[model samples]
Target: MSGISIVGVGNMARALAARALAGGNAVEIIGRDRVKAEELAGTLDGVTVGTAGAAPAGDIVILAAPYAGAAEVVREYGDALRGRIIVDITNPVAPDLQGLVVPDDSSGAQEIAGLAPEGAHVVKAFNTVFSHVLAAGPAEGRPLDVFVAGDDAQAKARVSAFVAGMGLRPWDIGGLAMARALENVALVELGLMNHSVKHTDFSLGITLLH
Candidate 1:
């Protein structure tokens, strides 16, 4: 399994790091606050910690920050992320959860991709899963489906493999352009949570008639 570096110290970051470590992948947690990063690492056995500005030790770097801060995080890393697979897991939605905040033609992942250093491939994923559900593992005896969108086939494959390693399913929806739809998918999930679902334990999934 490929190693992963998660650049945040929040709930999503901790959930992902725990799953990656459970899958036997090398996991590194990075944050602007080294102490918080170290604290998160301490909770997970065998995980390493690094400061935000340092070059990540993993081949795949997950920008676990929110949509507002993701670009700045990437800019801070700069060329250090060159040739790495940058995973964007942000859903740029309005504060009231009424609509998306990004422009109609450009998604948050697209915006992040634009800021990524040359040679770095940006892949959109995990935006549809809630942090608590992810931390709790699969839902209703089924592995959660992680929707992936990226122009780079190899990068998507790597992410898919990592998802499978964590006992989940990865659905390669299409190129990065489809990231907009994925973001909307998250919005739909949130809408459901606020209305019908009334909870955060569920995740978006697909069922194929075989």
Candidate 2:
């Protein structure tokens, strides 16, 4: 992708912005707190902070905010996102960071799609990997895999290519409906383990293999 705009300034967003910078992608961060966005951007090269209402126009718009906050931000940026590809990196993890609290039939990514501008396409991505790993990865010069899913095939393609640009593998898991499974509580078990276990590196599991 030509450019990326991340809509948060938290750890995940920081890591993502860093990856985009390391990969040489032009990146802008739209933070709910403008000062925080500017502060974060100051620490990173090739990135600038943006106001909540004026997210930069980019080929990729990534929602790095918490799932609980995503819908509202989508609504806030509805007009600015027309004809854009939005990538959702939020997991609906409860405050306890132990489990997901989203509805059974829906996912944060899907919810974002509902709140997005009429023509904007939303894709699920990045939540499956931990932020620290994203920043410290590529031990073997090969970034870890990144999985993406969206209702629009072209949107998925756009996001998948962006993921690939970050030195990672990108796998398309079909339409946006798959995001529910992608962000399921069960999917985070390994990530939790990765944090609890010091030596073991954990990745999200896909059970399509026999």
Candidate 3:
């Protein structure tokens, strides 16, 4: 499995690191707060904390932050991130955090794609899954489905492998434009979360009725 570079030190970033390491990938985390980054790294063995400006160059960089944070990190690391697979986990929800903040035809992933290097490929995944749900992979290690939307076929393939390493199956939803639907799906999922009685996360899975 290819190693992963995570660009934040929050819950989502930690979750990605845990899942990636558990999936047999080398993980490096970078962010603004060195102390917090180091703390999170200590929680997970085999994970290391590196400088934000000097984060490891990897096959994939998971932007595990909000859309605002994503933009900031991409802008700062625009040059270093060239030719790498960038996974945009940002969902631009309103202040209420219940609905999307983007207008029709544009999305968080699309916005991040704009700031990226010409050849840098960006995709959307893991936005819909609750952090806790992903923290614990499905029992028996069956792959959960991660719907991916991106423009570059090669980048998508790399991300697909990374997703699989985390014990999840990656489903291609077509070009980067497809991320709009993916984000909306997350909003719908959030609505469902509010009604849940407990911390048990409800995940979406496609099943054939036949």
Best by lDDT: 1
- Poorly placed runs, candidate 1 (over 4 Å): none
Q: How many clashing residue pairs appear in each of the predictions shown? A: 0, 0, 0
Rank candidates, TM-score, best first: 1, 3, 2
- lDDT per residue as tens, model 2, 1-210: 468889888988899998888777889988878899999999997687777877566768888887778778888877889988889887776666655677778887887888888888989988788788888766555458788889998888878877788887888988888887877643455555657664435555344456
Structure candidate 3, residue pairs in collision:
none
- Model 1 Cα lDDT, one tens digit per residue, 1-57: 888999999999999999999999999999888999999999999999976888899
TM-score of each: 0.97, 0.87, 0.92
Question: Model 3 Cα displacement at 207 (Å)?
Answer: 1.0
Candidate 2 vs 3: which has more TM-score: 3
Model 3 poorest ten-residue lDDT run: 193-202
Best by TM-score: 1
Report the C-alpha lDDT of model 3 over 1-210, residue by residue, as the tens digit.
886899898888988999999888889988789999999999999998878876355768999987898888999886888878899998898877576787788899998999998778999988878787788777454557789989888888889888887778788889999898888887777667666643446678666569
Candidate 3 has an lDDT of 0.84
lDDT of every model, 2 decimals = 0.92, 0.80, 0.84
Higher-ranked by TM-score: 1 or 2: 1
